[model samples]
Each structure stands twice: as structure tokens, then as C-alpha cells.
Target: MTEYKFSDRAYTKMIFHAAKYPHLAINGVLLAEKGAKSNSVVIVDAIPLFHQCLYVTPMVEIALMQVDAYAERENLVIAGYYAACENFYDNTLDKVPAAKIADKIQENFKGACFAIIDNKLVTLEQEEVALKVFSCNDGGRWSKSNYSLQNSKSTLEAVSVLLKRGAMKDVVDFDNHLDNPKHDWTNELLNKDLKQIMAMY
Candidate 1:
């Protein structure tokens, strides 16, 4: 429910975000009609307060279908699928590097609502942001966390330049969670560079 104005900043973010998607498609995991029509998903046109974005509120629609299994319930209930992926063909499909357009979304133009990534339905927010950033950034490809979000048009790249100077320690990695994942880049050049810049914080 955060409403944003239709300004250059907002348009810039929309362009970066929408460049990955061409159009919306189905989730591709519907049960056989005779098997159990219990769990269902729906796509609704969202008249958003910010940028007039479209959102696919899956849980609300699935609940209307009436399923009894908690696992199945949790398995597919999401609110942003239609706006994120094209078909959600597979779970391992990470295509952050493939989005082709970056045209900024107009303030109240009613943008599409979805929740897929690399072309698969997803529920992880940070991962989604990471994927979007991964799509927007060109020239070099690497994954980092808010360190990059700090570089969004809203932040005006000020944070990125600062981090490039010398920053803080214990910076949040893109994969940071209850327990840090070992595969994540740490003690790397970007981390060292950012840590140094964070000294100003």
C-alpha cells in the first residue's frame, strides 16, 4: 500500500523492473480437473495506488477454491505470480540476465501484476529484487544484496559511490538469512571494497 508519485525516479524503477517481462502467462501447475479442483488460482486486474501496478493475489483466489491440505495450500499460495513470470516452467530457471527492455512504467498506467523470476513462480522478495537488479545491470554480472539496492534510482547511486570508497563490515549479502549460506561471495573484492566504503557510515 505504498503509493509513489509518477516522477522520474518512479519511472526509472519501473523501466528497470518491467524490462524482464513481455507478457503474463499461467502458473502451469494446475491439478487435473477431476483430481482435486480444491486448490485454485486467480488473476485479477489491480488498480494500484503506486504506479497502478497489476498484482496477482493468488492466496485470496486459492482460498476461494477451498483446499484442505496445508502443504498444498502453502505450496502454491502467492500474491505476485502473474507480474513476475511468464509460465513458471521450472523452479531452477534463473534468467535474471535475459530481460530486454527498461521502459519506465507510467505512474498510474496500470502495469501488469506478476510473481515469477528467471521465468518461474517465486515467493522470495530479496531474490526477486536481486534478479531484477541482475537484469538491469549490464557490463558485469555478480550478485550482491541491498548494496545494489542502495544504488537504485531512488538512492541516486550515492550509496554505491560511497561503498566504492569504503563502507561497513557485516554488510548484508544477497543470500543472508537466519543462517548465512557458504556459497555466497564473502571476502571478495566487492565485499572488501564495500566494507571499506562503509567506514563512512
Candidate 2:
């Protein structure tokens, strides 16, 4: 049974997306590369879907196609699907769109998994937490698995900005009337002040 390893940058990306829209359910694809030491997957980046209606919308399909093309060029594979729900302890992950999404990804990438953001870590305690990974078993049932994080300077910088911005303090779906631009987080990642803020931590 192959396990998943999440790079800090990729983990932060998933948390940032969940915090960005805490009230609604957010889903995304995890890009990963084969590990060198053993049979494992190293999650590299996430492509988030802020807007989702029903199951697997046409827009989501198009986005996945584009992501797959990009991943191929980068020598990465669509290794998994991740979801953050309205409630922190939402147990519908394996029963939600994520199940179908993970199944679809596994069709091409056999060891694909699903990660559900542990909402409590974001809502209650402002501390480190491990996101859970579920890999499909022989019967296509999701089995709980383990994953470790890889620390990096970029990830530290990203965390600094999230805290300084008081992102977790905001109310989820507060800006319901507004639409989130896909590059919002990317622009923040390039913010000049981010370096200054990261230096403090």
C-alpha cells in the first residue's frame, strides 16, 4: 500500500483555500510526483475549485483537463482529490463529490487518494494538524492512511502571511456576494511584505 507525502507548500495551499472560503465546500486536485526512496507520492501543488454546484460540473471537468495537461508538462500526475466542507468535522468526505472525484483520478493514476481538510484545526485551535488521507482498497472502499509534511522556506512564508492577514479570524462566506479570482492566493504569494512578515516568524 503506497502512502502520500505532502510538501509543506502544497499543504499550505490546501489550508489557505479552505480558510479562504470556510463556509462553503471547496474541492481541488492534488498534483504529485513519484518519490525516489520508496513507493510513495509527494504532493506538490493544488488546483482549487472555489465554485462548485451539483457534482462534477462542466467547468470542473474543463479545469481538470487543463490541469492534467499542465501536470504532464511538469512531469507530475493527478494523484488525488481534496475537499473541505462547511463543518470542521464533516464526515461526508468519502460520501461526497470527493469520492467520485477520487475514483475518476484513480482511473488514470492507480494510487490516487482523497484528503479531507481537518476543519477543527482552522476553526478552533490555531496549531499544526495533520490532514487525513484515504486511499482506495481492493473493493474501491476508502481506507485511512498516513502522510508526512516536508518543511520549506516558501511554506513558512505562506503561513506568515495567513496569520498576519488574520485570515482565520474572518467569518466564512462573509463575502458571499463576491467572486474569488483564481490567482488571489498567487498574488498574495508574491506580495513584497510577505518576505518582511516571514522574517518575523
Candidate 3:
């Protein structure tokens, strides 16, 4: 099985994106570099795409084009897609929103993965990763896949501290950028802050 390693930046940003809009469905893309090992994927960052009308194609297409360009510039690939279900209890593969997007990612990147935010584990008290990953098989089916965090315990602790500090508000998604171009969905500042914060934990 291919090993997917999620960085603290990618993991926390996805969680923050979902926490930023608890009642809404959120979706995003994962950017990654091929790991040193042949069957390993290193997910480095996440670009939050939308929280409104996930099924809309025009906006999704626009966001994807931009993300693809950005990934190219950064020497990364669109390795995966992630979604957070509006219904807190919906953590299954069938409940993943914008699933076709995941399929499209897989079409381009054979190692593409789909991750669903496990809402039950989204709390500050939660110690484990809140994401449940699935990989597309040769049969065109999504099956549960294993993933690891960069620094499991410290990552969880830092996220909890960030949540307590209400840092999630700093995470901007494509919808926010669309509403106001000044809102940077790339989250350069937040990414820097997260790295600094993680180091302290």
C-alpha cells in the first residue's frame, strides 16, 4: 500500500477550514511532492477551495486551474481532494462531497487520495488525525487507506492550541477570496504562523 504522509500545515489547515464553517460543507485540494520512497506521498499543503455550492462547476474549474498553476510553480502536484460533510455524522466515502473531483484528481495522478473530515474527531480534545483517507483502486473503487502525521502528538496539541486561540478565523478559502480578493486563500501568513506555532509545541 502507498503511504500518505500529511504535513502539519496540510493537516491543520484542512481542519481549520472545516472548523471555520462548522455548519457548511467544505472542500479543498491537497498539494504534495513525491516522497523519497517509491510508494510514498508527502502531502505538504492544502488549498481550501469552497464552502458554498460545492457542485458548481464554473467556480470549481476556475479554482482548480489556479491551483494547478500554483502547484506547477511550486513543484508540487494536485495529489488529492478533501471534503468535510455538513452533517457531522457523515464520515463515510459515500458522504464525501465533490467526489467526482477526487476521481478527476486520480485520473491525473495515479496516487491521488480522497480525505473526509471525521467530524467526530474535530474537537480540541481529539488526539488523533481527524481525516479518513481513501485511495482509488484499479477497480475504480475507493478503499480506506492509512496515513501518518509528521508529528502526531505535537501536531494534535498545536491544533488544539490554535483552536483555543481562534486562529481558524485566519484561514481563508476560495469563497472568501471570491467575496473579497483581498482575502488570501493561499494563507501565506497563516502557514508561516502555523509552522512557528508547531515548532513551539
Instruction: Indicate which candidate wins on lDDT.
Output: 3
Best by TM-score: 3
- lDDT tens per residue, model 1, 55-77: 23353233223321321444432
Candidate 3 clashes between residue pairs 3 or more apart in a chain or in different chains: none
- How close is every model to the real structure, measured as TM-score? 0.19, 0.75, 0.96
Q: Which is better, 1 or 2, measured by TM-score?
A: 2
Where is model 1 poorest over a 10-residue stretch in terms of lDDT? 43-52
lDDT of 2 by residue, 118-184 (tens): 7776543335553778887888788887777664444545564675676533222212212454434
* CA error at residue 144 for candidate 3, angstroms: 0.6
Please, what are the lDDT tens digits per residue for candidate 3 over residues 65-107? 9999988888888999999999999989887757899999989
Candidate lDDT scores, in order, read 0.25, 0.65, 0.89
- Pairwise TM-score winner, candidates 2 and 3: 3
- What's the candidate order when arranged by decreasing lDDT? 3, 2, 1
* Candidate 2 clashing pairs, residues 3+ apart or interchain: none
